[model samples]
Target: MSIKVENLKHIYAPNTPFETIALDDINIEIKTGEFIGLIGHTGSGKSTFIQHLNGLLKSNYGKIFINDLDITDEKISLTDVRKKVGLVFQYPEYQLFEETIEKDIAFGPRNLGLVEDEITQRVKDAMQLVGLEYERSKDKSPFDISGGQKRRVAIAGVIAMKPEILILDEPTAGLDPKGRDDILRNIKEIHEKEKNTIILVSHSMEDVAKLADRLLVMNRGKVEFFDTPKEVFKHEERLKQIGLDVPKVLDLAKKLREQGFDISDDILTIDDIKLEILKNLKEK
Candidate 1:
């Protein structure tokens, strides 16, 4: 599904001493099937902006359109909107409460009033999408699994809802390197197979650089930039001014360039750097 935001503005504790603007005059569009990375320092309105996408938070002044339907309309049903926009929050594993993994993953489908057969199928598909074996893990207690497995189960719960637009906030937070890699791989596979629009809110520049088709940078209640990762990272000084850093691989590429390695400015990943270095060596 496509998304368009126009003149969006939101404030906290409005008309009070503690009042603060959380989102200010924000506007952007996300095309269908695009993988967008949402990045910003803490308290930069990233969270606030995403909440508006799913109607969790209402803007004081602005309009939000999902596929040409103005969701900001007062008469619109947020419940229906939520069905199309699934949000997987940070530390979602902590919210797991079902006795078994299958039940937890099936919860959303069941809530949608789907029949037993469809619910069963959705649960199975969701589990499989996240790399969980349906026959092996379905009956196990969610709490009994590893942390990374639990996270997958949590994500599976949202996936079972079959949302066209998926928003994941810090999905890989607090994981070991291996666990992080596993979760990221699952996300990539989901996007590739499902062809759904994905908004990944992450603090790791490397993660976004590897996966996102475009990066949406947020600042203090405003948009800083929206462009491809390679293009956005070009403004290293501007990013630094906002307390953000380019991926470390870019730093390595910069150092290689300093040493007359002729590395291209478009290199964004470790694999890209590796291939470039090998090619340069071969030329020498």
Candidate 2:
């Protein structure tokens, strides 16, 4: 769904001596089915901003419109907002508490008052969407799985609700390389097949480089930039000044270019860089 934010501002502990400005005069637009990478350093308002999208946190200074409806209106129900926007927080597995994986993933659909058959179908679809075998995992306790599996199960719970906009916050945090790869694969698969709008809030510049169609860079409670990743990553000095790094692949490309290897500075993905290296080496 399309989302538009106008003059959004959020403050914590307002009117207090320890008050902090969490979000400031922020405004942006998102198209339906677009993959947006929300990037920032710690305390850059990334977490706080996503909360406002699903109405978990309300903004008093501005309004948010989802599909042209002002969610800030008193008549809008938070439940309706949440149904359209699903949020998967960092280390989501920590929230899983059901007796079986099937039950855990089915929780959201069940809460939506779907019939038992529909809930069961949702549980199966969600599990498969995350790369888990329905028959093998359905009966297992959530606690018995590996860390990554448990994390997927948690995400499956949110996916079972069939949200139009999926927001994942630091989805690959605290995982081994293999586990991180698995989760990213699931994310890619779901986005490609389901065609849902995705907003990925992450600190990993490399992950954003590989996954996001557009980049939204935030710094010190303000939007530093919002554009395509290629355009945004061009501001290497500014990003570094704000405590963010360009993608590692881009850094490698720069070093390779300096070493007399012909390559573009805007290279963002490892696969593209690898091909460039192979082609340049052949020319050598």
Candidate 1 wrong stretches, greater than 4 Å: none
Please give the lDDT score for candidate 1: 0.96
Q: Estimate each model's TM-score.
A: 0.99, 0.98
| 1-284 per-residue lDDT for model 1 (tens digits) | 99999999999999999999999999999999999999999999999999999999989999999999999999999999999999999999999999999999999999999999999999999998999999999999999989999999999999999999999999999999999999999999999999999999999999999999999999999999999999999999999999899999999998999999989888999999999999999999
Cα lDDT tens digits, model 2, 18-78, are 8999999999999999999999999999999999999999886999999998988889999
- Which 10-residue window of candidate 2 scores lowest in summed lDDT? 257-266
Candidate lDDT values, in order: 0.96, 0.92
The root-mean-square deviation over C-alpha atoms between each candidate and the true structure, in angstroms, is 0.6, 0.9
Number of the top lDDT candidate = 1
lDDT of 2: 0.92
